[model samples]
Target: MNTKLPKLEPITSEWMFKFINNYELQESLFKSYESPINIHSLDAFSRNIKEYQEILATYNFNSKIFFARKANKFQNLITAAVANGIGVDTASYEELKQCIDLQVSSDKLISTAAIKSRKLLELAIKNKVLLVIDNQDELDQVAQIAREYNIKAKIGIRISGFYYEGNKLLSRFGFDIDDIENLLQNYFTEANEHLFNIEGFHFHLDGYSTSQRGESIHQTLDLIENLNSSKTSFKFIDIGGGILMNYLRHQNEWNLFKTELQDAVLENREPLTYNNDGLGYTNRNGQIEGDLATYPYYNENSKASFLKEILDTTNDSSKAVYQRLEQLNIELRLEPGRSLLNQVGITAARVAHRKVDARGNHLIGLEMNMSQMKSSSADFLLDPFVSYNNPIKEAEPVEVYFTGAYCLERDILLKRKIELPQLPEIGDTIIFVNTAGYMMHFFETEAHLFKRAQNLSVLGRKEHYTFDDFKTE
Candidate 1:
């Protein structure tokens, strides 16, 4: 399928309604969870995983995918990932402990975050986790901790990649590539028998730039070789992340929702009947008139296909570009944050209040907050899931602005102008689609005292259950 998006819907209708509708999965939040919510968006994590496995096949790269736990703080997400062959990335001691409690092997869990506490350090030393060292300070600290725990562990350097144009190129989390003081050379070079294990190198690019990622892997290998000086000890170079997911053909960019709330001033009107006899209805695009024989096909190809393509390109280019740094020598590592869990989760909340301002503006207040999501912008900032049960037809419509219950003026979620069947009631649930990525349900804003959104999971093919039962052991 074309990677580019089609004529976009104002909201994520494809995942919000189409996918859920076909599966016949019902949301249970309507009665118990909170008020004003009757059946909200359901499990996004479960839905995405089955799709991501397909994306992985696209690349033919079988690198272990360690799901970045910070992306979504859901235990069910961790459960789903552990169930798959993929691993988990935890930066904190508690998260690491949770990983162990969840039964993930120490080799599969890598400590990637730069900052760490004494407790976190102790666990890493005791558990023998793949500690990704950042700089001299961190490297020294790791050495001290390892000595204290006396564990013969593996270590990897967070190497800087110079792909970005300017000084922004040096990774904030990794050692400066220009700085020869990387752990391998400075700490382990003169040691009698490997002061540190010196596993390999790792680096992560922020956005979805393929060339930047390719160059990052290439540069990491170069940095590793230059530092080791023909005496390479380790066998892994973590590319870190950037495994794209396949979220069906229709719903690609879930965050592109835009809402125009300024003009929303809801006005109730009389209900009317539809012309079911094909009186005013017309198939302008022949959409309703097509048969399955002529309709375009749906591609369920695996996500691995894309990874393999990039991996092949990187591996192929490395031979001529950086001949000494073997391409197939080091084990490829990845921490797929969103790609592994994007389709497996969704967020559901209730609409609390609705009103029209003095200038004829319609407003909807939901119980969910924007900060709950790791994304900078609110859902529908690029695309929203608009309420389709609007009373006013498109030919004659009034726009509505959606907001959250918080006191701040920035609490708005959706600004898409649309006609609605009265503002969402105190009990109506508004679900956010495809929130299984970085937006998983753990941002219980302490600033606002917003309880962490309750996370739920679908067991096997039938049981729909809550996440509280699967807490840290």
Candidate 2:
């Protein structure tokens, strides 16, 4: 079955180009690896950090950049964040403890986990880490822990303002906006006020809408103003992370592909064979509309530039984001996960076998499991770059789906069919680009007793590629 697919161009850095061009080095590395491997670039990560710092410098107000640690579980990234003097956003008990053990200052760490266990709360209070209280119940727990430990818990309240498609709350992580007054009246009493320090407000949004973000900021600012007479102090606004990353370089192609696919399905043309119907959207007419399962693969603003856009956005006539923060004498804090990790890492797998499926579809099985690259999203849209050690026989190009070594029928690496210059043979390497963020470790497991992929830190330039094992533990 022939179908038109969107051509995706991945964002690449100088180091990535050098690494991809050095096929000999990559082949040698893959041949040595018993399992799939992830190549991380410290240079690329450093460049991303510098970009954030440079953009943040343009604003005149007090701001802090917190690297969301859940983006990737690699310990080197945390070390890099500490070395760069930036803060870390940890969502787990072990994550907070690990950051502290890595020598990261307690003030530079923010624990925003939804359910903070007693052990996590105790650790946060004992270490003086900033806790982003999710709800009144969590606040009570923190207050109790603080009263028990006789230490003031520095905390921020997370607010939920964004709504889903049907005006439903985006997530259960934050308190409803209407409950602000009730929360203040119940918890901000003189008896419990000194037990915890209500330092600021935070909201974690699901999408990357600058206007929505600005609106949230305005709402938070209004809340702070409303609490002017309250006993509790609020000094900052933590707009929790949802910074968009442009994974696809050719966005128009993606849009056009979606339109064409919808038209095809509506016209009763040969349907695009997805592993599951959930991969694409089905309209009321029983026609597949488009692929709604994927994230916004192409965004206008991403990484440091997105932050600049948010800062430049005007929430009111008198104040832009920076102006508002300055006028209120409050700090602006950000926790960016995926955007900060743009072009920092990639996952490479060796082709183990190739065969024609029962439906006449060509399938290339890679040694890596799907869990290694899977995230909460339905499928990773970025195209996998293939490298062949042997020369092609000048045969016609073939479209094939990449599957994993797992025995499960649904263990496909990429749901979409990708056209290769030639059919891949055993030992060829399939490299998925820009996978450093949530793709690397999120949902990763050693299922079927197969060992998890090893992470390698790439160093140096062309002609001399040095590799170091990045310890995950």
Regions more than 4 Å wrong, model 1: 1-28, 35-62, 163-168, 181-183, 190-195, 225-229, 244-309, 312-327, 382-397, 415-423, 440-443, 460-473
Q: Give a tens-digit lDDT track for model 1, residues 1-473.
A: 11111223322433445423322122334334542221222244445554555554544333456778886766666666666666788867778898888777887788887687766766776777888877777767777777766666567777774655454475567777766454345556656234467777788776555566666667666665665566665577777776665444444322221011110111111111111111122233432331122101122333465455445444443442223234445566777776665445556665667788775567777777655543542233223343322233434433566676567776655433434434455545555565656654444464566665655554443233343322221
Location of the lowest summed lDDT over 10 successive residues in candidate 1: 258-267
Error of 1 at 122 (Å): 1.4
Candidate 1: deviation at residue 21, Å?
5.9
Tell me how candidate 1 scores on lDDT. 0.54
- Per-candidate TM-scores read 0.73, 0.92
| Model 1 error, position 46 (Å) | 6.7
Best by TM-score: 2
* lDDT of each candidate versus the true structure: 0.54, 0.79
* Count of clashes, each model: 50, 0
Give the clashing residue pairs of candidate 2, or none: none
